[model samples]
Each structure stands twice: as C-alpha cells, then as structure tokens.
Target: MFTGIVEATGEVTALDLRGGDVRLRIRANSLDLSKIQLGDSIATNGVCLTVASLLEDGYESDVSSETLSVTSVSSWHIGTKVNLERALTIDTRLGGHLVLGHVDGIGEVVHLNPDARSWCLRICAPNELAKYIAQKGSITVDGTSLTVNKVEGAEFELNIVPHTLEHTGIGSYQAGSLVNLEVDVIARYVERLLLGDSAANT
Candidate 1:
C-alpha cells in the first residue's frame, strides 16, 4: 500500500519492451534508495512495480502485460518523469488516504485552466469508475492524492495548488493527458459490504 504522497519525481531512463511486457528503469532523482531492496514494491505513477534490480542512481522493474494494458505505462516514453512513492510501513504516517497502487481505470484530462492562485483540472473518468467518485472525495491522480472539488457524471474537477504542481508529476499534465487513477480504497470496501449477500447471490 501507499499513501498517495509523492516523495520525489523520477525520470524514466530506459524502457525495454519484451513482447507485451516491459522492463522499466528510472533515475530516482532525490529519493533515497539506500534502504530499498530488490523485490520491494514502489509506487511509480500509481502503479505498484517491484524493484527487480538496484542501479547506481535508481532501480529497475518489470511491468507485466496486464499492467501495461490497464494503465498509462504503455504510453510512457524514455524521458517521461514519474511520481514516486514507497510502500507504507507500520510506522509510516497516513498523510494521505490509503492507496493500493492498483490503477483501477485510466482517466483523461479534459480541461486544465489557471485559476486565481492555483490551477483547475477537469478529468473524465471511465464510466464504470465514475459511480464510485463523489464530490469532496479523495482520488489519486498520477500518484498524487487530490480532493475532488466537484463531480458531474463521469467528470470531476480538482483544485491544484502551486505546491502540489511543483512536487508531483501533475504539473506537466495537459488537456489530452492520460493518467493513472485509483479511487479511495475505503469506498470500494464499503460498497462490497453493502452489497454483501446480493453480490454472492448473483
């Protein structure tokens, strides 16, 4: 699990495509990788990728075909910079909501405009995932936790302060940008409990 709090921004140094799968290497920027070991999980752009190898400046991970198909990783280029977050430990602070590093659905940025002191982004979520999103709810976008300012059908608006833009990969987003999205983990569990027997009966 992750907290959706991005520790640093890493640059994608290389990408090796093996049929449908991929091997990705990233330069870990200012992030501390001294304590990280191989087989440990790291959230990169909201996808949980295991650290396959340690590099001088960063690490490498293998992306499965299913992960490539479900998220925006397939479109990432060599120079693409990604938000990075380590998995939560028992002593880790929950600064942000609990995130599984599982990309539920990919969303598209429909509008990005400058507001008074911040920027306003309107993203269109997948129809199936839209129902789970609520106004004032938390949603992880490109590995950054953001509150939903407003929700209209399958689209939602977010107010991004200058600090957030500078800290995460969200600053580089454009209107046509594709992003990895993970809805609140609590909401999913609640829905399952409410459905209960009905879900099993089906």
Candidate 2:
C-alpha cells in the first residue's frame, strides 16, 4: 500500500526484453536506496512491481506480459522517468490514502491547462470505472493519489499543485497521454453495496 505520496523520480536506465517478460533497471534520481530491499514491492506509477535485484543506486524488476498489456507500461522505454514510492509500512504516516498499487485500467490525458500556481488536468477514463469516481473522492493517477475536482461522464478533472507537478509524471503529461488509474477502495465497496452484491453472494 501507498499513501499516494511520491518519494522520488526514477528513470528507466534499461529494459532487457526477456522472452516472456522484461527485466527493467531503473535509476533512482530522488529515490532513497537505504529504504529499499530485494523482494520489496514498490509502486512505480501506480503499478505494484517486486524488486528482483538491488543495485548501488537503483533496482531491477521484471514486468510480466500481462502487466504490460493491461497498463500503460507497454509504451515505456529507456529514459522514461517514473514516480517512485516504497511500499507503505506500519509506521508510515498516511498522507494520501489506501493504495493497492494495482491499477484497474488506463486513463487518457485529454486536457492539461497550466495556470499561474497550478495545473488543471482532465482525463478520459473507461465508462465502467466512471461510477467509482466521485467529485472530491480519492483517485490514483499514475501512482500519485489525487482528489477528483470535477466529474463529467467518463472524464474527470484534477487540480495539480506545484509540488505534484514537480514530484510526479503528471507534470509531463500532455494530450493523448495514457496513465494508470486506481479508484478508491471504499468507493468500490460502496458501489457493490448499492448494487446489492454481498460477501454471501461471492
């Protein structure tokens, strides 16, 4: 789990396309090497990836074919900078909210309007996931947790502060950019309750 707080920005140094998967070596620019370890799960742009090897300044992880097919990682390449977050610990402060590091689907960046102090970004998401998004509700975009400022059909707006723009990949977003998305866990349960599904049924 993560609090949606970004620790540092890491760059993809290399991606060795292994037969069925890819072994990725990431260069941590602002990532803390002290807090990382082998087998530790990290949230890379909202996708939960296990560390396969720990290097001097970065780490290596493998991305499965399914993970590539589902999320936006397929387009990723060397030099791609990504938001990095070590898995949440019991003693960690909850600055964002509960994040599973499991991205449900991809959302497209349709609008990014920059202003004096902040940026207004609008994304178009899958219609099915629309119900899970709410105005002022929690949502994770590319591993960075943010609140929904507005909602219209399959589109939602997010206000990005300077800190967010400086810390996460959303700062580099443009029209037609595809980003990973995770809806709030509580909202999922609430929707299921409203839909009449229960634990007994499943």
Best by TM-score: 1
Per-residue lDDT tens digits of candidate 1, residues 1-202?
A: 9999999999999999888789999999998998899999999999999999999999999999999999999999989999999999999999989999999999999988999989999999999999889999999998899999999999999999998888998888998999999999889889889997898985
lDDT of 2 by residue, 1-202 (tens): 8888888889889989999798988887768878777899988888899999998879999999999988888889998889999998889999998999989899999989987899999999998899899999999998999999999999999999999998788888999999999999998877668766465586
The total of clashing pairs for model 1 equals 0
Tell me how candidate 1 scores on lDDT: 0.94
Candidate 2 residues lying further than 4 Å off, grouped into runs, are: 194-202
Candidate 2 has what TM-score? 0.94
How many clashes show up per model? 0, 0
Q: Which ten residues in a row have the lowest lDDT in candidate 1?
A: 193-202
Q: After superposition, how far is residue 70 of candidate 2 from its true place, in Å?
A: 1.1
Distance from true location, Cα of 109 in model 1, Å: 0.5
Error of 1 at 11 (Å): 1.0
TM-score per candidate: 0.97, 0.94
RMSD of each: 0.9, 1.6
